[model samples]
Target chain A: MRVRVFADADWPQVWQIVHEVVRAQETFPYDPAMTDGQARDAWIEAPPGLTVVAVDRDRVVGTAKMGPNRSGPGAHVSTASFMVAAADRGRGVGTALLDFAVGWAKAEGYAAMQFNAVVETNRSAVELYRRHGFEVVGTVPRSFAHPTLGRVGLHVMYREF
Target chain B: MRVRVFADADWPQVWQIVHEVVRAQETFPYDPAMTDGQARDAWIEAPPGLTVVAVDRDRVVGTAKMGPNRSGPGAHVSTASFMVAAADRGRGVGTALLDFAVGWAKAEGYAAMQFNAVVETNRSAVELYRRHGFEVVGTVPRSFAHPTLGRVGLHVMYREF
Candidate 1:
């Protein structure tokens, strides 16, 4: 499946994916109090530059955003977050979205890419990032509060793309 | 320098140290609108089982907390953050706090440590974590808006400790 940048009209499908994903806040570390508008700000509302989505067979299956990882003279690296429809897992959708992110960050001249908070137990995502050459840099040690699990750890990984 | 865990009575000095280092939203990822109480919850209200502080000569130079990174089966790992008074930089205060977190996580049975939402622009802090054997694992590009820079990226890093 080919992936491309999301347009304004594509938000409906993105919202659907987000809506379902929000129900899994126990794992995502997103505000469990998140509403549509908040999701809009989180996923849409590209700040100056850097927002995109992934589509497959005419449906938006995944979404991700990328931009300057920091500011001041240190703002050379880029960062991104990705989401894929539950049904779309194991189809390489996430890799494609990450691929898009890497290309975009490189084109933007970012020195590297960083992911700030990945649930530590999300082993598959961690493995996928490791397969892509990202490294586990630093950890916050018990950050996000999962709904069902009570508490868990998060991972921060990065790569130069 | 040594790290210790204490209650709110220990907070005045802790806040003093943290405020000295993390005053500007530009320095930390916290909201510019965050109040003292909110920041306290963000730092103090862990999953009921983790908190800490760094003291140099019985005067708190820095403070931090650790606990389950998330809930459910994912709770095997821990996440933490540290804030050192600007005056205490380079005195091994941060290293001490981190060491405490590492030992505490190990003793508490966490499998790893993760950092969620590390500001990509915070080079010194990032580098410190790197020197401590952490790796940059994931990035949420431009997830935050800075007062001066408009938008900045967030980095997610982790280590097994």
Candidate 2:
């Protein structure tokens, strides 16, 4: 799979992935009832930030949105979110997207990258980030409500460039 | 000191406090170069959230803004920020504002209050939150840039109602 800048045409596929992930109520803490416009506004980064898609043979397999974690002094550190198509799980689309995001942030001169909330129950995502040199800096206990696990901690993952 | 809903008349005093705190660059991570309108937009809460000021004999001594930490599923947890005039530091203005914010969040049916970022170098602020039952759930290392102290951790403080 190859990652590329997201285009206007990619919204439908991106929204589908976002909707499914949000509705699953497992990984992301996003509102499941989020409207299309709300999702678009949230996912599509403006100006200094960016959105990208991973494609495999003309099909969008995963997507990521990245930008500064906060404004002013905190902007030196960046943050990002990713989602892979459920059916394309083991094909490394997520990895490709992550690689692209890291590269983009480094190129953009970010001192570090921080993921504010990674559901603790999402083992695969945790492992994936760890494998890429990210560390669980801290976990806020009982912050995320996992559908099956009830309330679970949310991991704050970090990686310095 | 008495806490009351923020009014248009209070903006001048509120802006002065906000400007001093942000410019100090030792506590809040807000942009020091933030314009008056930008500061207003960031400090003022719309609709679901509320902003209040601490009045001591007709003088606004402190201010606080509270709202949901995140939208949708995460909205159950509330977040807030406080600012007290430098000259009013030892007089318990911060404590009064904290008390008011906590009561407001509980009355609004929030399950908990989470502070996303509290500079570790800001000892008084940290101690005040701790006294009010907020625990430092996690500290992200070297996330904040302190002008004289170099880099310091930012604490994620939380309190469940």
Candidate 3:
């Protein structure tokens, strides 16, 4: 799969993945009932930030959005979120998306990459980040209300470039 | 001082405190050059979230804003920020504003209160939160570039209601 800057054409497939993950209510903190318009506005950020996708044979299988975690003084530290097609799991799509994001951040002069609100129950993602030099700097206990897990922790993961 | 719901009339005084703190470039992550309009838009939040003032004989000595830390599934957990007139420091205004915010969150049925970014170099604020039942759950190193200290950590503090 090749990673590239996201285009308007990727939204439909990207929204499909976002919808699935959000509706699952087991990972992200986004409202499950978020409309496509709302999702697009939040996911497709403007300059100083970026949204991208991973394509395999013209199929968009994963996407990532990253930018300064906060404006002004904290802008030097980057942050990102990822979504891989459920069918594409275990196929290295997430790794590709994250590796691209980290490289993009470093190239953009970021001091570090931080992931806020990573659901603790998502073992695969946690392990993926850990392998990518990320560490759980903090955990907000019972911050996320997972549909099946009752309540789960949300980890604030970080990795310095 | 009396803690009361904020009104449009309080903007001037509230802005005074916000402008001072933000311009200091030592505590909040907001852009120091932020305009009044931007500060108002960010500090004076809308419904499901609250912005209030601590009035001392008609003077707005401090302000507090509270709302869900994250939307949807994470809405049960609340978050708040405080700003007190610099001249009023060590006079108990911060504690009063924080106390009122915590009480309001409890009455609003929030399960917990989390501070996403508490500049570690701001010792007084951190100590204040600790006295009010908050604990540092995690710290992101060199997240804030202090004007004098070069770079400082950002602490994520948490307290359950």
RMSD of every prediction: 8.1, 1.3, 1.1
Q: Can you tell me which runs of candidate 1 are displaced by over 4 Å?
A: A45-48, B1-161
Give interface RMSD, every candidate, in order.
Answer: 7.6, 1.5, 0.7
Worst 10 residues of 3 chain B by lDDT: B67-76
Residue-level lDDT tens digits of model 2 in A31-130: 9999999999999999699999999888998999999897766778889999998999987887888899999999999999999999898998999999
Ranking by DockQ: 3, 2, 1
Q: lDDT by residue for model 2 over B93-121, one digit each (tens)?
A: 89998999899999999889999989999
Instruction: Give residue B51's error in model 1 in angstroms.
Output: 21
Better of 1 and 2 by TM-score: 2
Instruction: Report RMSD for candidate 1.
Output: 8.1
Model 3, total clashes: 0
Q: Write the per-residue lDDT of candidate 1 for residues B91-133, one digit (tens) a residue.
A: 8887888888878888988878777667778787788788877
Preferred candidate (DockQ higher): 2 or 3: 3
Global lDDT scores for all candidate models: 0.72, 0.90, 0.93
The DockQ values of the predictions, listed in order, are 0.10, 0.67, 0.85
Candidate order by lDDT, decreasing, is 3, 2, 1
Q: Write the per-residue lDDT of candidate 3 for residues A1-161, one digit (tens) a residue.
A: 99999999889999998998888888789999999999999899799999999999999998999999987788899999999888999999999999999999999999999998999999999999999999999999988999878878999999999
Report the number of the highest-lDDT candidate.
3
